[model samples]
Target: MLLGLAGNSCIGHILRCFRAKTHSSFTSPINSFQFSRSIYCATMASAAAGETRTEPVYFSDTYLFSFDKASVLKAEKLEGDSNDYAVVTDQTIMHPQGGGQPSDQGEITTSVDGTDVVFQVKQVSKAKDSQEIKHIGCFSSGSAELLPVGQTVKMTINEDMRRLHARLHSAGHLLDTALNRLNASDLIPSKGYHFADGPYVEYIGNVANEERDKLMASMNEVLSDLVKENIATQITVGDSGERIVSIAGLPCPCGGTHVKSTAEIGPMKVTRMKKNKKNMKMSYSLESS
Candidate 1:
């Protein structure tokens, strides 16, 4: 079954950000692609020698970096189900859905001796370890090419998809900040919260209907100001340590990419509000001009 975004509200925003970019902009990197291929080969050889390292898992970390296109080492497809899959590259620019975020969508292309052979990518997932990662793509019916183990391949993510998911994920952070501030100023204690996909965000606690309205209005007002979204230095802490990134007046620990400014979010509208158990649910959507 296709994973639903119902209870997983926080990831909804990420899906939106990544779903908006154009894939064509990610042509093979400009410098000699062969150099990247050599690096990929070398990396694979090292891994074969039993050197183990943590693969950087977020696409945002490497999306903007230009490297020899061949740096990505292809791995064998260890396992897969119908919808989810696992694939390992010498390195990757795809972010899996973990830590309350969604995964990415893109294609992996393999060339045989400088000639394009096959291209396909339906969905991506991470394996339990870096060594046995697999990428699952939906191939056209009766397609002949099968991605054999050790085949030299070039992988590219749908750039627009990454951008959209990033935007929504960042916006969700802003929403959390808004809720925290409103609750604090009003003397309401927040009990729980989640930012549903698209614009539906909810915070659970002892907040009155009037307070919810006020909070929404205040957030909209802040959005109107179009504050800039800055990349604060990433501070990684122990699992129990406090992590914080402030956008507008909100601060929290966030390990996701965001737009440079809030104004880029365009206009936001709160469409629905309700209560679930002791928690409140607020649904919203972005207004496109």
Candidate 2:
């Protein structure tokens, strides 16, 4: 995990790294937002108007890895690119690169005229203020078939990478709970970079220099015990419509995917603590599973 300060920018692309069922039914712990059991249709009118939104299935089920029924909305071959193409789907299990978590790497597969075609998804991203998620990559070599818009395809994300991202994201929240246990709950959370390069959480508050060492040691102890207790993560609807994730019953407003339980987060250690101005950035890591 990333050890850099929370405010440090994450590299746009990680060096080589890192879904499930169509219409899969997953009931979150809270009666927040109910997801449709089918892909949202992009009307021809909207497609003609160049407007389409992807239904993010990962929001409802973080553990789902393979989705069998995602319809391709558009496939455009780049003009000056090296056999590169961009694809958009009606529904996706791929988590786009955002919110400090990295984009999911995977492949989209579909058969055309009794021949198999694959689009290797190298990066997933969504435009700012847009719901459409674009999968950018190239068709597997030897075949230059572009997926027809409206053709059904299957999506399978790299499960190991997804799990690692979930673990990292969850570990960040666990640190928040540790702060509360340390009686430093007054520190306002400012930024969290859960990227694998060096995950860290920054708080806009201060702890005395003399007390810092004790705090880090105690924080690690609390995190170890929390993992041992194997507390299940809970999701509940807040007064507003936001999804509130509670790790070990400590609530935080978060949109990133997370592990199912604290145990799944494995062992986490606060590797470094730095006080930058009024901000305290705590870098951490989790044991590899």
Q: Name the best candidate (by TM-score).
A: 2
Model 1: lDDT equals: 0.44
TM-score of each: 0.60, 0.81
Estimate the TM-score for candidate 1. Answer: 0.60
User: In order, how many clashes per candidate?
Assistant: 28, 12
Off by over 4 Å in 2: 1-50, 78-80, 141-145
* Shift in Å, residue 95, candidate 2: 0.5
Go through the candidates in order and give each one's C-alpha lDDT: 0.44, 0.71
